[model samples]
Target: MKKLIKLGIALVAIISLNACTEDDGFTFIAKEDPDGLTFANTPSGSYTLTAANADNMAERFVWNAVDFGVQTPVSYELQGAATESFDNITVIPAGNSTNVAVTVSEMMDLAEEAGLDNDPTTAEPNTGIIYFRVRAYVGSNGGNVVDQFSDVISVTVNLPEQSEEEDEDLPKLYVVGNFLSASGYGTDWTATDGVPIAAEAEGNTAYEGFVYMNVDAPQFKILQTNENFDDNYGDAGETDGVYTGILESPGVNAGTPDGTGGYYLVNVDTDALTYELTETSWGVIGNATPTGWDSDTDMTYDSDTQTWSVTLDLTEQEATDNGFKFRANDAWDLNLGDTDADGSLEFAGDNIGVPEDGNYTITLDLSNPRQYKYSISKN
Candidate 1:
């Protein structure tokens, strides 16, 4: 009977050891807390997925725990399906991480699989749809499995339009100058020579005329002409060894002759107009009398032939004794018309008869002011 009791105790002990060993068997229970997190309600753009340990137990009690020696390396995998059964799900390796960039299309797919009409097409069938979702993967020495899925997200895109008036309102460009008026009208204006007159609109100012140039050292040309000759007769001459003159007495002709030639000799008459030009207030270099005028001193207005004549014969004593040298000022005068005519002298044209000097700025103001464009500059 004692031997029987000993054998019973040994069997009991063996059973106890078997029960402990069976309880310690390597069995794993995957516990993913919350199962899934929904990101469909979040804003669009970029995001990062984070892992949360759900178990309150020590790290050793958690199977495939990241802290233990079970070699739990987490990866991510994306899945899209039409239903919760996930029978037709498409699985892609999300790589080795808990975070990944979720695309718009994937978000739309996730929304569709969740039976949610978050996709634009699903909500408004006329439009297209974009879907997205993400799933984390837990890898262990034994095997691997997807832990949970995030909520789905969706978005839509559209383009804008433009108008015609906006395109037409763009700024326009114009050439820099003034616009010319009808041709050949005396009331119209003309531009200075060599200097171009431009029409341009810049900022707030629209320039419609020639720019007034600064006159630095203005100049004038002296014009001396005989006032006692007619178009038919030449200068007064010696007839029968007596000098025949055009001017009668000073009281009789009033310093000008009507060409009948009564008292003073026409050729010797000092009844010509004298024009003076100076360089910076100095005395004139060009001094001449009617007989002393070189060929350069002569000019003719073909349209009004009898209006102007000159001779070169001014003596050096006459020029020195009197301050009769030419003077140059800021202005010039026009004196080539027949003063005796009843407006018969309508037009006048003459060449510039001044000697070539240094550079000068010349401005010609036509009698009508607006008849034509004239240009003058240093050559």
Candidate 2:
């Protein structure tokens, strides 16, 4: 009986050893190792691109097939970068192929985004080496799962010359209806003398400016071009503080002011179909100002001069270094600072330094929509 029991135990040990030895799973490896890829059509030498031939073909990059060590599908990608190490890179996929053709226009965008100037006429010729390499990987989806990179090659690119044309001026916006200095509605009663709001930025479709809306002229609509009843904007009823809520074309349902009428900053965005009204107020606040940065010393606006001014006393000892900034509505939403410390105000810029200290009258001139200026005069 003891001999039979020993034989049974020996048989079980042999079965377990066979099972463990037969469980060898498959492993993945680079078939070509990617690093050994040869570029069959990599462009060499320098090339110049221009807007005249922007749509023309620049180059077609071709590379050898990469093996993912299995029948599972593989993908290829062509990448370009400003640096040789692939830093600040842009990539284009090859679908399921090992080649890609690039256009001059597409290459121009890539060069510009890589810190090259789009205009070659005025700016110096952007002569630098652009690096290119092929990336081979498994799966078509996007992620950090990369397999290998082909040998890198470089080509020099010159900035493309583009034709210079002055940007067309944005159409003007006139205040219509009874919403300004006068109290009357309709196209005939054009508020040409009311207030002209111009575009805040060159290509922006938004216009903004200050308008004094009183209880009498508390409501208004905007007119495009001539004071014709053909087109205008009314209310869209989207949210609070939106005057041009719904557009009313030839029809009229002028929007009303949110709060008591006063000199308010009215901003209109036609593309977004929205309008905003903010009370025009300014204040000087900072560690350098008499009042600390937490609170602002209010500044008053003069309609005649079209400027915001304030006179306050400041001491060198009080202003610990971080100086001061101009804020609107006593809130951080709209603030200006001298980023360059050159006595001019930049929207959302750094704090202004107190060049010494004493009583002084500060004036902010925003008359020029493109150029805003401010002056600190010793009292």
Candidate 3:
């Protein structure tokens, strides 16, 4: 019995010695979190590091446990470079956690101190590439020694280019005008004979009527020329010296047409009064008028006649109230007249109202020599 007991004690001692030797040879290696680490093309302004171990060695190194035979303090160093090869690296201390985060700005300051022109906000450094790795230190009675390095991770920063263009400013203007008779009769009333007369008060005959145009800004100069005109006489009278008289209205088409006229549509180049008319309502002569002319069509310049025309088939009431107006931004009075086979008695003029932006139409009754219609719109 004594011999058996001594043998059991020897066996226990040998087992303990083997365990000690095995524990002393064990090592704690630095590792990376997520097995293999990844970073954004442009990393967040800051980042953190996490150490992991598949062999369950993290607690031994990261937590400074004694199980791994650590006799002294343990510290960590993070190295970064422009290449995964880790050449020309920068080192920073790792705090007391398995993971450590550092600000890109802070890292940039460190780079500057190291004689590198690296802007964390830009990708100008590291030849447009960045890399990171971790090293762990284990201290013993002899001295501190680096255990192992984690796999290197690549990082990239995307920077925006400096060249971009801005939008351009567009030009705009507002105009107003009045429509009055060119005969001695009141603006709203014309001679029963329907003889076309000039606004002047001399020669064959004279009349007192006027129209006005007002623009928001004075940036643009006016250009006026007679598009068409007719005299009641059989022979086509020369437009010799057509002039425009300016007038004002309480509201669009509200002021008395007989009131003394105010501003004239003078030619920009010649200083002569100008007027224009279209042969056929400028292509807006549809059989049926749409629900909203102002919302549907756009006014275009008629190069041939030097006039702008819009056509509408609205009723007399729509024409008088909403259609025909002499207020500001309501009309463009041309120094021209209507001279077609329809005869002098069928002469008509329109007071087109300008809306926001779009197309519109204006209509006229050829049967009646002295009256016409107009519409304004955008598309």
Local accuracy of candidate 1 as per-residue lDDT tens digits, 163-241: 2233223222111111112111111112221122111222322111111111221111101212222221222332211
Highest-scoring model, TM-score? 2
Give the better candidate number (1 or 2) by TM-score. 2
Model 2, position 118, has a per-residue lDDT of 48
Q: What is the C-alpha lDDT profile of model 2 across 13-53, one tens digit per residue?
A: 01111211233111211112121111111133344545433
Best by lDDT: 2
Cα-based RMSD of the predictions, in order?
Answer: 41.6, 24.7, 31.3
- Residue 54 CA error for candidate 1 (Å)? 36
46 Cα displacement, candidate 2 (Å): 39
> Which regions in candidate 1 have their CA more than 4 angstroms from the true location?
1-69, 108-135, 138-379
Query: Clashing residue pairs, candidate 2?
Result: 235-245, 235-246, 236-245, 236-246, 237-245
lDDT of 1 at 204: 20
For model 2, the run of ten residues with the poorest summed lDDT:
1-10
Per-residue CA lDDT of candidate 3, range 172-226, in tens? 1112122223222223222231222122211211222222322221111111112
Residue 185 of model 1, lDDT score: 15
Quote each prediction's TM-score. Answer: 0.18, 0.47, 0.24
User: What TM-score does model 1 achieve against the real structure?
Assistant: 0.18
